[model samples]
Target: MPRPNVWRDSAETTRLWVFDALAGFPLILMLLHLRWWTFGVAVTCFVVFGVLERMGYSVRFALRRLRAIAGGSVKLGQPWWGKRQERL
Candidate 1:
């Protein structure tokens, strides 16, 4: 049998935000303590989220979907780095 859609089960809905915060808190702490590696830390966080979800979507894609359901200003397929000011 296929794995149940644990992510969508109503029982799991509340836990999702809880888990998100739990993961983010450590990253926030590290960012506050370390003044360097800002980009590296952010990329690490995105990878962590994608790994945690174990979904096929890219980190940005996953966040796009999550934001869509949660209501946010982000557009789909936008890179985790946000909009491009200039392409070289």
Candidate 2:
């Protein structure tokens, strides 16, 4: 049997929770600002970012994904903490 992929699993979970919390931040702010459209956009971007992050993608990767959605083709996938440090 193969060893379990614990690192990836934990990374994904952390990414999801981070994005979820980020999404909530804007929503909470919106409650005071009363900007419904901005709130919606924030939520949408949060979900998109969360999905990309959970898929072993970095912030640049998430930005690239958004650019792709906006009709561009830019590839990016560097770990946030740099590749060498990731092994630690």
Candidate with maximal lDDT: 2
Q: Give per-residue CA lDDT, model 2, range 15-86, as digits (tens).
A: 344664444555676777777797887678777766766787766665566777997467578987786654
Off by over 4 Å in 1: 1-19, 55-88
Put down candidate 1 lDDT per residue, 1-88, tens digits, no spaces: 8987766766432333434444464467677777557657765875677586675434446667787889867655878589768878
Q: For residue 80, what is the lDDT in candidate 2? A: 72
Give per-residue lDDT, candidate 2, residue 48: 71
Q: Hey, what RMSD does candidate 1 come out at?
A: 13.7
Candidate 1 pairs with clashing backbones: none
Q: What is candidate 2's TM-score against the reference?
A: 0.38
